[model samples]
Structures are given as C-alpha cells and as structure tokens.
Target: MGKRYTVPARQGLAVRLKKGEQVRVINTHGTQVVDSWAFNAADPTEFMSMEHMRQGINGIIPKPGDGLMTNKRRPILTFLEDTSPGIHDTIIAACDIWRYRNLGVEGYHDSCTDNLRMALVAIGFPVAEVPSPFNLFMNIPVRPDHSIGWEPTVSKPGDSVTFRAEMDLVYAVSACPQDIVPINGAGLAPVDAHLEVLAEA
Candidate 1:
C-alpha cells in the first residue's frame, strides 16, 4: 500500500517519511527539474552534502539506487529507482553571485536560493534556515580531462525516480529557476513532482 501526493512547481509540500517507507518522485512532464534537500527529523541542520553523498555512494555519481548521506555520515535517503535515463547539472551548483557576474548578468536578481526561500516560507520554515539542496534530475557531467560541462537535461517527459528514507526525515524541493545556463535550456519551466509513501515491507 502507498499514499500518494502531488506537488506543483513554485509550491511547497511537506511529508514525513516514517522509517522503512519508500518515497518516489515522478516528473509528470518531461524536461521539468527539481532541486531537493533532506534533514534528520530530529535535527534539521544536519543536512545532506553532495560531496559526501558521492563519496558515501562509492564515488559514483548519483543515479537510481544511490543513497544520499547526511553530514554525520548517516543515510538520509536511498535512491531506490529512476525512470529518467539521465538528469542535468549535478556539480555545476545552483546560481549565485559568481554565476551572475560570470554570465554578464546585472546581478543575482533570481536564483535557486531565492526559490528555496520562497518554498520554506510557504512551509512555515524561516527562510534563513533553509538548507542546501540536492539537485534531482540535474546533470553536470565531468569530461575525460576532469573538467565539467553543464549539459542538457537527460530526462524526458514522464520520467521519475524512487527513494526510501533511511530514517525519519524532512525534505524540501524546488523546480530550479536557473535559466542562465544550458541546464534549463533557454528558460525556467515548471516541473510536476508526485510523491508516494509505500507500505511497510
């Protein structure tokens, strides 16, 4: 048995992942992106790290079955499955001061942090307390020479991924607003994400 919930873009949604329940995120529309972050229910600040996540998962880039590890080396969530063949921009990171300056944009008028802040406010969390997030369905590939290139989205319409919470956890997600790069192609688009809680196995 599973409980299903749907979250639309620019909206905030919260769900408690009881130990052992599996959660799946479905990209209902193709090319839509989602950035996510997780915390221990007991202590929200102990967040997940992309570096640690990659290392803990054996230096492998996250994919289906990859586990996202917390700063304390605890398993926060496990990537149980993914339907999208590939996602976009993992290592390129969210937009910020450096990005805006480098892109020759006026300044950081809009960014992933801004979107995350909005989502937190909607969910009743103080905007200042929002944690760093995991970029789901984002692909940044490293070239053979060790350089990285922001690539186009590997996900197509209707792609999805499934994860299992290793502990009681709280998570936040946002459809990225990074139109300054190839990740979003030319503009920001809405992504539809659906969550389902699986019955105890």
Candidate 2:
C-alpha cells in the first residue's frame, strides 16, 4: 500500500522516492497550490533544472510522459499521470519575501521559498541551493496577446498528478500561501493537500 499524508496550509513536507516508485499530489478541496522541488539522492548538487528540462522538451509546460531533466541534462523524473488538465506553470518563480514587499506588504509574510528551504533540510539539502519549483494545479493561461491570465484553479477536488522517480530522489513540497490572489482557490485562506508515495504497480 502507498503511504499517504496531508500537508496543511502554508506548510511543507520532505519525502523520498525510490526508482520506479510514484508520488502523487492531490488537491484536496481544489484550493491549494503544491510547489515541488527535487534533488538527486546521490549528489544533491545535480538537481532538477527547469530551464534545461523545458528546453529539452521544447515546451514551457510539461505533459505526461515528459522526462524532467537536471542541470546536467539528465532525466530525473517522469510525468506518469495527470488527472487534472495539466494547466501548471514553470515560468513563475516561487513566492518570496521580496515579492510580497514589492506588492506593498511587508514584514515576513509566509512564502514558498521559506517553506521549501525548511522542508528540504529535513532530507539533508542545504537551503542555499534550493531550486525553483514545479507548480501543480496552478492556472497560468497565456492570452492571444501573449499576456498572462490569472484564472482560478480549474482542478476539481481529488484531482491529482503522479510522477515516477527516474532515480532515487529527495523531494520537497509546499502548499502555497498566497492569499492575496485567487490562485489558491479563493486565495483567502490556504488549505490542506494529499501527498502519497505509491509502490510500483
């Protein structure tokens, strides 16, 4: 049986996955964003590089069967299944202190970068080398004019995306806490999400 756990609002988690094992992230109430990052278990320095992965795939958004690559351009994980419409974003950086401050809000608001750093440490990764995350269930649409659209989530409750670890890996996730925008459901308050480590079928 696979191990399942819930990540509360504005919180984070660190988990390990062996090669061939699959991990699924579920939007419990359709009101949360899961920011996920991965590292090579043998050498943390060679982590997933969104830039290389995207360029290798020749697309900004990855689809099922796409193999995500590392800075060294090696495949690390594969998108095995996506129950949602695959409307995720790789262009946007995870939220941080400087961003909130620029929005005229100050004083240490909760952020994805902070959550990722905290979560990754549990798996022995240094905070300084944290990479930009792969956002799941985030609806960032491109208009005909090439401008971005901030549409609310189109994923229904229980929607999920599962990934197969191409190598032994350490992964971290943060339930995004951006209440100022309607990105996370209503965005007024964050909610919990489900993370599961499923055995090979």
Candidate 3:
C-alpha cells in the first residue's frame, strides 16, 4: 500500500518514509534518465552506495524487483517487479569536468551536481554534504573486453519499482540532463517520475 504522487523535471519534492513503508518510483515515459540517492533520516551520513549496490547485485546488471541494499546488507528499497523489463545504468556516473571535456561540449554549463544541489536545498539539507548518486534508467554496460559504452535503457513507460525503507529515510532525485547519449533521447527529452508511499504491512 503506497500513496502516489508525481514530480515534474526542473522542480523538486520531498517525502519522508517511515520505517517499513514501501515507496515506488515510476518512469512514466521511456528513455528518460533519473539520478537518485537516499540518506538515513537518523544520520544523514549513512547513504546508499553505487559500489555496494553493484557488488550486492553481483555486477550482473539489475532489473526491476532487484533490491537496492545498503553496505550493511539492509534492504533500502526493492524494484517494483514490473511485467515489462526495467532498464538501469550500471556504468555511467554523474557529470563533472572530465565528462564535460570528453563530451567535446563547451565549458561545463549544466550538470547533475547542480541539479542535486538544488534538490538538497529544496529539502532543507546541508548543501556541502551532497553525495555521489545512483543513476537509474541510464545504461552503461561493460564489454567482455573490459571496455564500457552507453547502452539503451531497459525500462519503458509505466514501469516502476518499490523500495522499502529500512528506517525513516530521505531521497533526492533528478531527471538527468545527459546530452551525451541516446539514453535520454540524445540529451533532448526530459523524464517524468511518480512516487508513491505505501502503508506498512
């Protein structure tokens, strides 16, 4: 049982997840990228880890219903178990100076960090403590030869995943501003996400 809400891009929202309450994020449209992260409501410093999540998922690449677990082996959230395949990026990281130069784009004008900073401010968190995030719906696959390339998204419209917070938690999300690949319509389209808070079972 979750309460549903929608969030539009370039804007932000905040929700508090009581312990044992399951929450789901829905990608209403396909190919739209989202950058997400979670923090412990009690300690803020206790955050989700991309490395830990990858290791826990066994580097096999994740699909819907997969658990996004913490380093301590606590279940932070679970994929919503979509009937349609849910695609997520495993290799692409949040944008920074190196990426800006690699993309051959002008100076770093827009970025994920900027979006994240804004989100934190909106939620009344310390701006300086914002951490690295998890990229959802953006595909970055490693080749057998040990190279990496951006790949097509595995999710489509209306696909979603539920995350049951092990404790009271706060999350910050940004529909990505990736203009370097087809994952987000070659950086042309925007993403829409819907969140729902469910009653504890």
Candidate 4:
C-alpha cells in the first residue's frame, strides 16, 4: 500500500507523479467535490485542458480508460479506474472569489482557484492561470433544455478514481470549498479527501 495523503477540507494539496505511476483520489466522506489538475513537470504551461479533453473523448465526462488531454493536445494522465458513479465534470471553471462575490459573499471565500494557486506555490511550482479542472465526483449534469444543474455527487464514501501519469507531472486537488452551493452535498459542507500514489507495477 502506498502512503496516503490528506487533502484538508477547504484547502488544496499537490504531489508529483512520475510516468507510469498511478494516483488514487478518495472521497473519504462521499460529499466533497475535488477539483483536480495536472501540469507537465517540465513545463507548467502545458497543463490539462478540459476543452481539449472533451474533443478527444467526444464527451464532457471522461470515463475509465480515457486519456486526459492537455492544452498542448497530448495526454497528461490516463483515467484508469473509477469506483464511483462516474459523474465528474469538465465544463465548470474552478470557483473563484469573484464567483462568491456574485453569490453575495462579502469577505474572502475559500475557493478552488485560490486553493490551486496556493498548492502549486507550496510545491515551488510557478502559479499560473487556473485551468478548467477535472472535477472529481462533482455533479453538474446538462439538462435536455441545454442548461446545467449543480447537483450533489453520486459517489459513496470511500469511493475513488485512479489515474496513471502519462508523463512526469504535478497533480493537484482541492477539496472544493463551495459552501454556498449544494454541489458538495445537500449539507453544503466541504470536507477532507485523500490520495495515494502507487508505484509502477
């Protein structure tokens, strides 16, 4: 078993993954939405891109065995396994303070975008513009009316999704702090998540 790392509630964490290695992210409470991103270790600018991934996968939600495409139009991580309902999102932008402001939050609100920035800085990586993350376990289903609904995750406790590193890269996760919305759950409470990096078999 690999050492497990805690992604604190309302915060972010980042780790390095070498090519061929795999990392599994766990929804410890089954209620948190983890916004996730991967960046090339050699070039942070070449990070995961949801737009490209949608084009590559021919869908919005990537399934197991899909290669997550990067902005450079290459695979960054390969979706390996999903023990959840596979209700992840690729269309929403990482939540930011501006988003909270619009929701009538007067003060600084913990946001996934800020969490991503801080997490990268903690790992000594240059902070860059927030990319559209592969929102693990997040549920934003498109309706027949061509609109979307922010629904709670359908994953159960201890559910996880695993990905294999396509190249040496930095992976980040934010146990999203979207308290104003019910996306995390009906409770609207964000909680901790976990991850483990596995060595190549």
Candidate 5:
C-alpha cells in the first residue's frame, strides 16, 4: 500500500519515491498552493531545474506528458494528469525571507524556501542545497501585454495533479503561508493538502 501524508498549512513534508512510483497531490480545501521541489536521490546536487524544464518543454505553462527535467537535463518526473483547470505556473521562485522583507514585512515569515529547506534537511539534505520549486496549483497567468499576473487558484476540493517518477527522487512540498497575499485563497488563509504514493503495477 502507498503511504499517505498531510502537510499542514504553512508547513512542509518530504516524500521519497522509487523510479516509476506515482504521487498525487490534493488541494483539500481548494485555493491552497503547494510549492514542491524534487531531487535525484543518487545525487542531490542534480536537482530539478526550472530553466531546463522551460527550455525542454518550451511552454509558458506545462501540459500533461511534459517531462520535468533536472539540472542534468534528465527527466525526473512526468506530469500524468491534472484534475483542476491546469493553470499552475513554473516561472516564479519560491518565497523567502528576503522577499518578505522587500515587501516591508518586519519579522520572519513562513516562506517556501524556509519550509523546503527545513523539510529536506530533516530528511538528510544539507542546508545549502535549496533549489527553486515547481509551484503546484499556483495561478499565475500571462496577460495579453506579455506580463504575468497572479490570480486565486481555481482548484476545487479534491482537485489534484499526479506525476510519474521518471527517476528515483526525494520530493519536498510546502503549503505556502503567504497570509498577506492573494495567492492563498484571497489572502484569507492557507489550508491542508494531501499526498500519497502509488506503486507501479
């Protein structure tokens, strides 16, 4: 049987999967965003690279069957299905303390970078190995003027996206805690998310 985990709002979790294992991420309450990062289990230095994915997939927004590449240009994960509106964005970097400071926020705030680092570190990754994440369920759309704009997620309860592991990997996910931004359900609150792994038949 596959394992299941619940990532609390503003927290993070780590999942290790063998090659060919499938993972499904569910937005339990709809409108919550999950920032996720993937790493090659054999070599942590060679992690997921958004630049490579952009170049390889060559799409403003990735589609089903698009392979998410690593820093070494190897396919790490293949997007299998999306039950939502299929509007997740891959262009933005995960949130961090510096970003909060830039926005005039005073103290330490929950950010994806911190969350991913904490989660991965607990799973044995070094503190210096943080990488950019693939923002799942995030709604950033390119405008007609060629600029991007943020919008609330359209994912409803039970909406989900599943991915097939192309290679053995350790994945990290953070339920974003940007309570001051509209990205988290109209800036109201972050909600819990569900994750589960499935073995290949």
Candidate 6:
C-alpha cells in the first residue's frame, strides 16, 4: 500500500512525481474542494496552463485518459482514473488575500493562492506566478444565459481521482477555504483530503 498524505483543511501540500508515476487524490470527507497545480521539475516556469489545456482538449473539464497540458504546450500529467462524479473546474483563479478582502473578510483568511506558495516553499520549489488551479470536485454550473453558479460538490465520501505524471513534476493541492461560498459543500466547511503516490507498474 502507498503512504497516504493529508492535505489539511484550509491548507496545502506538495509532492514530487517521477515520470510514469501515479498520484491518487482522495476526497476523504467528500465535502471539500481541492485546488490542484503542477509544474515541471526541471523548469518551474513551464507549469500547467488551464487555458492551454482547455484549448487542447476542446472541453471545459478533463476526464480520464486526457493529458494535462502545460504552458509550454506539452503534457505534464495524464488523467488516469476518476471514481467521483467527474466534476471539476478549470476556469476559476485560486483564491487569494485580495479575494477575501473583496468578499468583506475582516482579517486574513486561508486562500488557495497562498496555500500553493506555502506548499511549494515547504518543498523548496517556489514559483513567481500563481496559475489558475484545477479545482477538483468543484461544481460550477454554467447556465444557459452564459452565467455560472456556485454549487456544492456532488462527490460522496471516499471518492478519488488518479493521474499519471507524463514528466517529472511537482504536484500541489490545497484544501480550499472558501466559506463565503458553498463550493465545498452546503455546510460551507472545508476539510482535509488525502493523497497517495502510487508506484509505476
């Protein structure tokens, strides 16, 4: 069995993945949304790009067997498996301090943007820019009028998604701390998630 790591509530964690290795992200509580990112181990500047990925896939959300594209227009990771309802977001920017302030927060609130930085720094891999994250299990419904709605996650407990590293990479995830909006769940509570690095066969 692989060692499981916890992505603490309202916090972030990062891990290194070699080529062909797989990482399985678990929604332990099934009510939290995990903001995920990837960067080339060789060059931090060549990181995952949602815009490029969407253009390559010709779709909004990625599914199993899809290669996650990078800013350099190359594959960094491949979606291998998903046990959840397969709902994720590639459009929303990671929440930051300004986002909280704009949401009328009085003091500091945990944000995914900061989480990503802290996680990378913890792993001795810091980047200059904060790219938009792949919001795992986030439910953002686009209405017919071209509007979007924030909805709670639809995944049940123990749901997970697995991805394969197409190249050596640094993977990070933040247990989103958005309380003002109920994207995590109707309870508006953010919780810890788990991840396991699987060996390549």
Estimated TM-score per prediction? 0.80, 0.94, 0.81, 0.98, 0.95, 0.98
List the pairs of residues colliding in candidate 6. Answer: none
lDDT of 1 by residue, 1-201 (tens): 376677666444556677777777666666656777776777767777776777787764676667788888878988878778855334546555566778887844556666666655665554345455667777677889988776657777678877888888766666665665666444555555676778656
Residue 70 in model 5: shift from native, Å? 0.7
User: Per-residue lDDT for 1-201 in model 2, tens only?
Assistant: 387888889988989889888899999888678888888888888888889889989998899989999989988989889988788887778899987898778688989998888888766766567677888888888889999976678888999999999999887889988888778866467888999999976
Full-model lDDT for every candidate: 0.67, 0.85, 0.67, 0.94, 0.86, 0.94
RMSD, one per candidate, in order: 3.0, 1.4, 2.8, 0.9, 1.3, 0.9
Question: Model 6 over residues 26-86: C-alpha lDDT tens digits?
Answer: 9999988999999999999999899999998999999998989999999999999999999
The candidate with the higher lDDT, 4 or 5, is: 4
Clashing pairs in 1: 30-157, 36-134, 87-139, 88-138, 88-139, 89-138, 89-139, 89-140, 90-140
Model 3 local distance difference test score: 0.67
Pairwise lDDT winner, candidates 2 and 4: 4
**Model 5: clashing residue pairs?**
none
Please identify which of the two predictions, 3 or 5, would achieve the higher TM-score against the true structure: 5
